[model samples]
Target: MLRSGAGHPDAGQSEASTSRQLSPEEEAQRLYATLNEYLLLEHKAQPRLCLPNESENGEVTTGARDGAAHVLRCLKVWFDLPADVLINAISLFDRFLTKMKVRPCHVPCITVSCMNIALEQYAADTDTKRSISVEELVSISQSACTAGDVIRMSRVIVDKLSLVTGCRTSTVLDWLRLLRAMLRLHADQCAIVLPPSCQEEELVQLLEIVCCDAACVNTRTSELALVLLYYKLEQQLAESLAAAEESGTIPEHAYYLYDFARQLQLHCHMCDTTLAHARARVRHVLSRYERCEARRDQRQRLVWRLSERTLKVLRPTDRLTSLLPTIEEQHFAVDATPTRTRSGSESSENEETSDWPRSPVLPVYCDN
Candidate 1:
């Protein structure tokens, strides 16, 4: 992460140094305006339809395999996105299709309905009638879905998620982050550190449930940042704990999970790449711990305080400080192997002015 107020010639300083001198405030205003413009452009460029080549089957059809293929086509047309997001979407679609057996022609309607359900859950308390505008969905696909069908499908999607995970977007995000975090902490421990062999698999199943919930609709909550960050931290701490036990590189401390989570939040941005890296680390740790803790039922029992009932939300900036170790203090710097990079436009100038917002920092902890 690059610092905003650093001494690297003040960024765009070169343009000003050799030419007409604009005041600092004027420069600042220009920067803000430029940033706003870039943001708008990126928003416009955000993926609405999946890549065309992947779903180029000529015309929609029926029957078992064909129905599956047709649904995939509808998915391709409706906000075709990356694998993670798509996996979630498909889960919702499958759930509804299995129960409702929506016709091939109605694919568009169901797609819209699913998206609206997600919008409602995520946006909450808003007039969802205008929530997922049809224009945006239609504009993206050559074979667009009807407005009526979209509305219909949303109802079913919502019902399914409500049943599967109590219809709470926050819970889903919490579970996903926790699983990702635990996997990051250590996969080996999943078999050994956690109380039972089923612990890790159970969490993964929860994530699948969430993904299925989000799929038909986009229902992730505002607290997603905090949820993700918490997962990342828990995972790293788990990994560090196990690694220390083996190599003696770091000392093992009881209930050190809180401190580790805090440290990651302080030093790292909660970007997807950072989260993914954290997840990978946890996966490695779990795989290793499983071999040694194969017989121990309670070896890796680090408590994570994620429930809203137990934890208090802190001011976004104070998230890092809020998670400092309560008992013994051990400090360490994380050498993260770069796992995330901007999607496109690698020019130095373009990279410098890219409009994406840095991931917001949020922290939460159990109320002791």
Candidate 2:
């Protein structure tokens, strides 16, 4: 979340400080060059995941990814981790899933392990001790895996992907920060006052939400950032128009902002139609994630359907039947016959004769 405008002007700063370090032409050329460099880096670093179609495994893989994204988002917020860490974690998790075939049952363990890796990598850069231990992470995530399991999974991820987790990966937020700075520089060089740019915090949060979409794993970082940026711009414009009409006056900087958006498209070499489609897709997924989050918050209890194998592990004798009285015990209260001898050999013929039906009854007892 570091500002991309290190040497450039910051928001709310006077134009005097902005200076004339780069002319309009120079600024445009620089933006284009920077876009090219990011394009290459994004190609090399963006995560890839192929989500199964609806016909596959009841969409278990897709659900796992989307679920992991949301959980990681919450975990990031809880840990107060930087916005980029969530992206890095999710990217690593999805990439690992893409590299191998993972069962749905193991997805939670893998998700938590990926979060641990992301934290370790990010913690190194921050030079602080990790507040959450491996055991704590497992417990907090409600993962069935133990600390050792998470640790082992982390090693497996490192080995399978061969990715160096020592440094931060280029994420969508990085692209957005750079793009926003490019826009600001463009405005400064053109001497055209545009509306106050979108807030970085809001943009970062929105980008994080957008990443919850499983489809986003396939999206290039540059394009995803551009879509979010453009969506925010459009949203701002609409609000401005609404306020302007109410005030009976056209908003200042409207035309300038519109032109600036066009320049951004051109600088990024994105076709207008393609950009619009992407914006629509990003908005749709954002809304979907929001709705789901709302429902999640309103949930009164944990409601999940565990598979049969998991049920067995959790409920020995179904965890309920073992406590209940059998029909004979409930009705007759007869002393139970011992099924095992002192020698530990079976003493009840019925117990060893499971291969035969016992309910046909004796010929004398039945109406023949």
Candidate 3:
């Protein structure tokens, strides 16, 4: 967790009065350094989009990333895991992909393993409920990975990144906490009411939704949280003022709009122009997501079936089938899509990996 007023101390009445004597510039500078302490978790490390091996479809990649994230969200809701688990899981997933090469077929496995790792870390730190076992996770996610695969992948990820690194990096939640405090302090200074209508859970849910956007993968969490709050508060303020006008009554937070942004920018070191662009991007992404959601809702009412040709090739239970090789399926098969090494030679899975049940006479994996 990002400690508030980190590396700083509280003061008594006399000391507090002395602090009040500082100039505005000095105060802002002091607060800025304190706020920036939240970003101590490798701020230089940014996670970017990782394309699947030999795949060119950007839509598929986006869909895959979003789809995987949605799986984590569902798991969180299903298991009643803390919000930290979901955010940390997504961080692990993004960072792991950014740090290594992963095949498209392995995406589901990788995603689940990341979630499991996060869940374990969270549970260990908080001493909460035990994580879902590897077998159950594979079954629930329908990720097609074997229990062994999840274990191996989890080990690989942990070996690559430290356990705390996922949560150590500032997340949307951390930024939201900081911005909320700043907003509250500014509202008090203006002698205006704070947000009366916005609930904490609502704000949390909105930020979580915003984090789901592909654009946010590498975007700064602080800016995303700031803009999200800015838009929400601005909307609430407008609504309150309009209602107050119609009702001939003063609304709570009526005067809170005065110098609303000064402290946020000064304390958080934000650029107005950059924030504006990020807010626009987030707005566009949400609009697009809502439209997609509406379409999905409509489609849910209708029965859509695969084409006869597709059904002929795909079994009804194909989605539920495990992708892991069984004893009979473990013989070395020629890579249908061979990858090239830097030496410019074709490399295939046939180039010895883990010990497998071998059959010398025939290919275990039938492409057909």
Model 2 per-residue lDDT tens digits across residues 1-368? 22232212232133424665655566556555656666655655656677775536644567678888888888887877787678878888877877887877888899899899988876765568877788877887887889998999999998887766344446676678778877767667667554454778888888887788776667767778888777777877898889898999985676665677677667667777767767778878888877978899677897697676665676543323212334564443368755644545655674545454422221234566
Off by over 4 Å in 3: 1-34, 42-45, 50-54, 57-60, 129-131, 164-167, 188-191, 244-258, 292-297, 302-368
lDDT per residue as tens, model 3, 1-368: 33333312221223556656754455445555556676565363357764543457432376678788899888888778778778878888887778776667888888889888877866665557775777888887888789999999899998886554323455666567656655665665667666764556777787778766677777677777777787777777788788889999976556465356555655567788888888888888778877988888557466667674565465443233234455554444576654545544745554543444332222257778
Ranking by TM-score: 2, 3, 1
Residue pairs of candidate 2 with colliding backbone atoms: none
Residue 73, model 1: lDDT of 40
Which candidate ranks first by TM-score, i.e. highest? 2
Q: Which segments of candidate 2 are over 4 A away from where they belong?
A: 1-34, 53-60, 165-168, 189-197, 246-252, 289-368
Candidate 3 structure lDDT: 0.67
* CA lDDT of every candidate: 0.42, 0.70, 0.67
Q: Write the number of the candidate with greater TM-score, choosing between 1 and 3.
A: 3
Compared to the true structure, candidate 2 yields what TM-score? 0.67
Q: For residues 323-358, write the lDDT of model 1, one tens digit per residue.
A: 334577656558755466666647767664464334
Candidate 2 clashes: the total is 0
Could you arrange the candidates by lDDT from highest to lowest? 2, 3, 1
Q: Model 3: how far is 69 from its true place, Å? A: 1.0
lDDT of 3 at 309: 55
RMSD value for candidate 3:
18.0
